[model samples]
Target: MKYPKIRELKEAIVSLLTPAYTSKFPAEPHVPFEKFRGKPSVDDENCVGCETCANVCPSHAITFTDDKEKGIRTIIRDYGKCIFCGQCEEHCITKKGVILSDKIYDMAVFDRSKSIEYQEKELLICQSCNAIITTREHLHFMHRKLGPKAFSSILNLNILNQKLRLAEGQDVSVEIKDGLKRKDMFNIICPNCLRVILVKYLSKGV
Candidate 1:
């Protein structure tokens, strides 16, 4: 109650009355670092199918298969066992860039077996012809690259038709003749085949 005893009691009381300094997590959110690892992404348009990412990955979380004849490749990413090493992103062939996201960190699940790898469908791309035969959008993309004048050439049209017929069968046609007055019907090949036809025509000098 006096001198040293009084001072010690007062100090203890004051400390107990002071506000808590530690974080109240549920009441207040915690902030993470700027480069937090979230989900991974791939810009398919830029991906050259090099498989460099799969080769360098320490965890073997990435897999890529190449189609030599078509010159197209497929990639699959397994995020379950991913170590967030950033090695894949570093080795990616895309010059634009690849980076981790801040969204999917809590994606872990109780089913370990099911969490292994999710397969994604890949597009079959032609290296030399640059044809996207699988989907219509890819066909349009190829056509856009080839442009109009080259697109309309008769030889190119016939060649394109031949390829389409070979792949889609002879029943499919893309030919059209005459105008609004005297309409005619015909079969036509897709745009990719058209370009190939043009190349053949030029070589023949016909």
Candidate 2:
């Protein structure tokens, strides 16, 4: 019948058509939408290690174990549990996109622990003035806030080098000893305090 012939013709045409979907695993990677939620990358220099991301994470994928005495904060990410919800990125206060990075879609490995890697180095604090000197991001942020002139006036080889320089035989180190402590002081002292500090230091010829 005519119906049988039409069905046979359709099937023949279908055989000539290309496959609808294909995976880009080995040769190429698939592109995600611009807003796609992926892995979180910390700009440790910018990150004060506030542990805000860890506290806000619904999945508990982020962990921060800070040693206040040492002024060291360790950040750990569990990729396996991360929902990629972008909560961390949203909460970061730094304007430099601290929690920003693309997810490796094809990042599969035998050991799950290896998938999580630490991107930041140990945040070394200034032992003398309790200022953040090691992190380029922190220094950049400070410079931006104070302006170039003030930055140069306040920070020179002498001041910069003295950040971690402790007065020998002192009972207690002069450094802040923790990012949280610095942040607390930061809350109390805004741009006004910075201006005042710069003016005072410049007048004293420090």
Candidate 3:
């Protein structure tokens, strides 16, 4: 028993002399390990303001506000409510739009507002109802992703081309094509109006 106690004491002394395995956080910069999910970052240039990140955020940390009168869409991300989940990064249409960064976790702030990040983009209005439909960049992104045939069934290519032209500040006119013209309106239609028109058109077998 005495020898066992002496051996235990010697082991404790050796441990005390050995280097610490625990990290000295705060005193020294703490580097996060590989695949560590930390803060989320958004690249506005690639984001297109799709609202996918806001919709997929499990913590409800991301929010979107649309100002129709001002033709602006505002996206807000609150790091204080973020759970460091990678959902936003995974579901982003453009992979480069959102990403989980390995940045240090020093998010302490005196004012809670300081932990919030905001981004704004211009909105595209419906040419018919004048309602805010989506962002200009988002329409362009969809056009690039889906190509000209994407909206062929629901919308005419000529109309879509006119919409793109209108987005570029070009003057264009809406002409009746294939006997399908809605008050000579072209460019874009609100979802509600589109649904109603599609239902009526389908019922007519045209």
Candidate 4:
């Protein structure tokens, strides 16, 4: 290494004088450029726990679990597996549910669990078949989107009645114990069971 070529010497000098292309992240604060895709931030007020993010996530970073007994739906977001593809932000039904943040991008972590997040919403379980219905928040979101048309469905009407407490202390679950009867219409029955009730009983004017 006694003698260096003229081109090599010139290249060395140029590199030494030029500003670094890589930023000193830990040593200095760095602001990302405009339209930079970074961490995905959630707006809980607008998020209805619809599982739409989980469905569209290519990396499977988002997951959902429902506990029927507790009437709760848990949403899990593992940032360690996230590719920051912006699919969650793009397909969000509410449009304001999830969005990728441009400012906060530092996600370095030693433990994987530290990068995980959990959120819970009330589940709207079917009282008849015990089937897993959508979350209460999701139904409310649909009600807002559908407006007056939402009342066309008996399930939505029952949910609205429960929220408004039209009957006050009257128990809607009283007749659900016997079977899928006409009275089950007053309770939180699923669309399938509601269809059965209408076809079998209501059609004959029971």
- Top candidate on TM-score is 4
Clashing pairs in 2: 127-164
Off by over 4 Å in 3: 1-12, 151-183, 194-206
TM-score between model 4 and native: 0.94
Predict model 1's lDDT versus the native: 0.53
Q: Order the candidate numbers by TM-score, best to worst.
A: 4, 3, 2, 1
What TM-score fits each model? 0.40, 0.52, 0.74, 0.94
How many backbone clashes does every candidate have?
10, 1, 0, 0
Tens digit of per-residue lDDT, candidate 1, span 1-206: 37999899999999899997676654665444678876566666655555567788898888865553443455667778688888878777554334566754555467766555433334443323434434322344445557775446543353455555643554432223232111111233334554554565645764
Clashes of 3: 0
The TM-score between candidate 1 and the true structure equals 0.40
- How well is each residue in 1-206 modelled by candidate 4, as lDDT tens digits? 53568779989999999999999986776678999999898989999999999999999999999998788999999999999999999999999999999987888778989999999999988888888779999999999999999999988998998899885786754426667877777788888888989998989987
Ranking 2 against 3 by lDDT, winner: 3
lDDT over C-alpha atoms for residue 199 of model 3: 69
lDDT score, residue 112, model 2? 95
Alpha carbon lDDT of each predicted model: 0.53, 0.56, 0.76, 0.89
In model 2, how many backbone clashes occur?
1
Model 1 weakest 10-residue run by lDDT:
177-186
RMSD of every candidate to native, in Å, equals 11.2, 8.6, 5.1, 1.9
